[model samples]
Target: MVTDSQSGQGENNKTNENGSLPISRRGAMSRLVSLFLFIGFWTGIAYIASFYFLPFIQIKPGFIASALALVGILVAASVIFMVRVTPTGGSEARTLDFQTLIIVVFGTASLLAAGGITALSLKPPLLAGAILGILIIYVITLFRIIRFTFRSDREIEKIRSQYQDLIKIERAKTEFMTVTSHQLNTPLAEVRWGLESLLSAEGIEKENRDMISMILKGVNRIVETVADINKALSQKDKTATDYASELKTVQLAELILEIVNVLGGVAREKNVTLSFEGPEQEIFLGGNKDKLTSAIKNVIDNAIRYTPGGRVIISLRKEGASAIIRVQDTGIGILPEDTPLMFKKFFRGKNALLLQPDGSGLGLFTAREIIENAGGKIDFISTPERGTIFFITLPLKKTA
Candidate 1:
């Protein structure tokens, strides 16, 4: 039977398989520490040799200023050496991991050398004892560094393994969300179309019609939930590349008119009159074309969904340096309490929720994401029972 430590060594220690003694990483670190200890001890011996000679050497008038200039040059050289030794990962590299130890040891040695130059008249025996004390302190500091380095190496190994495991777990989660969302969406799409057909049919009792409407609403809600999951998972997959970089001149009026046409079915279903008025001159700007289109579409779409048998008027014009998009809707409007959370994800106002129970609560949130990503602003004005107006203001990206 093998002991636990031997079994762990058999699994993790590759050298154990070759019939040789396993050398732990700590052994090499100890050897490196011994070399440093010898260097520091030898430095104290040199300090003693310099004591008598330093007293005999005559002091020159410019010596202090020249010495200060030499120190400044050395400090500048150390900074340059550190920058050159920096790894490809840049400033965060571990090239200067032992900087504190180096600073302490170098400063102590400098103090000892300077003290020897000043304390030359002292007796040899007392001078030897003082040097011994300094060497003892230096040896202790080296030992402390060896212990810290050993522990830190172990911690780094542990963190590396944990980071790898975390990556695998996150990938598994993204795959699961993507697969399930796609599976649910297929059947939900069929159900949505079937409900729309049923709602359009004639010869149904008023009581039964309400029941069908409720069932259709519930189906729509499930579809929206599935869509939210897909969108959430895709956001995790999108990298910095998906964000806008290049710009193209875009006509805001043309885009708004196209969105109004696209949402026509929903407007007709709700008996909401939707219209768009363009500016005198074609409003041109530079932006991410696709993202801006989605932003404008979501805003107009929300206006149609919440309004009950009313009109929505969208107009575009310039306000000083910005192109203003004014969307006025005769909807349920928002309550004062819910006003602050207007653009938050999955946060529907009390009145909006009561109007369309199937609302995903992502419409305004997505709109904000798109507009802000393109460097624009969205604001709103509302009354409790009257109506609401949303304003989208974007700085005109000028063209030559």
Candidate 2:
């Protein structure tokens, strides 16, 4: 039985976080050198056995036994090293340790038993040639194994370092966006409130009222832009539970009606017929109200802007457990080549640019981000020069 003192010493030796004895670069190198020495010693013993003990056994029997043993060892070695090493949980180091054990145990045992028997059973002239061939083969095989092991470890370390750097860069970017969005939101909110107050005053002239209304519209757009930035920032590095505090039940039909009402003037100016269709029974889903409003508003506004004198229809209904919102528009449809990049930030199709050269190309990108974050999906199908249909699907709030 192992003594308690020996057991305690074994436990004390494992100082690494992974419950393994710590090994530095120098210590690993020392182990590698020791491995080479073991290989050399094994080769020497094989040479001695072949030279002195071959006569003791029949040549054919000795050759067959040695061949079988060497084959088994090579198969075992290959199997040991074939396991793919992942970068997680110090697996690379563990693989190295296991490989060392395999090489030392299997290499020594097989060669001591069979290495000389297989090669030395031949005539004297062939004996030297056979020995040299065996040595070359083993040396090359071990060198390749050592090279692959350390090179993979180095590559894994490089990838880990790059991943850490990318994380730092992303966090820094998110912080900058958070700060900029807040700074933009405050001033934009003040401007909107001041504009609304001016427009509401009784003594304001008709022309002045129109101008203030236009300015208010501009301010609202700025506020929406800032809110989009904030939403994008919040969605990064966050989970569903992180958003529980902000989500609330939203009535899909009412929201669609409200967006239609707000965009009515824009549709009229473009001579586009705008309408909303919904089921008599109200459908509700869970999401952030302001963000959802912005998302729907963007889709509808884009429809009106691009449709000109065509019809734009917004509809909402409940299908099983999902609330479906469809915005179908008779507008300049997306080009086939641009489909793959449709929802990428700042991506604009050739047809869309032709329709509105000044478009910021952020509307669809922001819409998808907000909807997806709220456990929803947004997709579209388009036929160039004919029309486009956008579909938004949100999970319906479960009824207890």
| Candidate that would win on TM-score | 2
Candidate 1: pairs in clash: none
lDDT digits (tens) for residues 208-327 of candidate 2: 899889888777767866765675566544445655568889888888898999999899988999999987798988777887898889888888888999999988877789887888
* Alpha-carbon local distance difference test for all models: 0.66, 0.68
- Give the C-alpha lDDT of model 1: 0.66
What TM-score does candidate 1 reach?
0.55
- Predicted candidate 1 versus true structure: per-residue lDDT over 4-58, tens digit per residue: 1110111233333333434333222344544554464455435434444444345
Candidate 2, position 285, lDDT: 80
- In order, how many clashes per candidate? 0, 0
Please give the lDDT score at residue 167 for candidate 2: 62
Global local distance difference test of model 2: 0.68
Question: What 10-residue stretch in candidate 2 is worst by lDDT?
Answer: 2-11
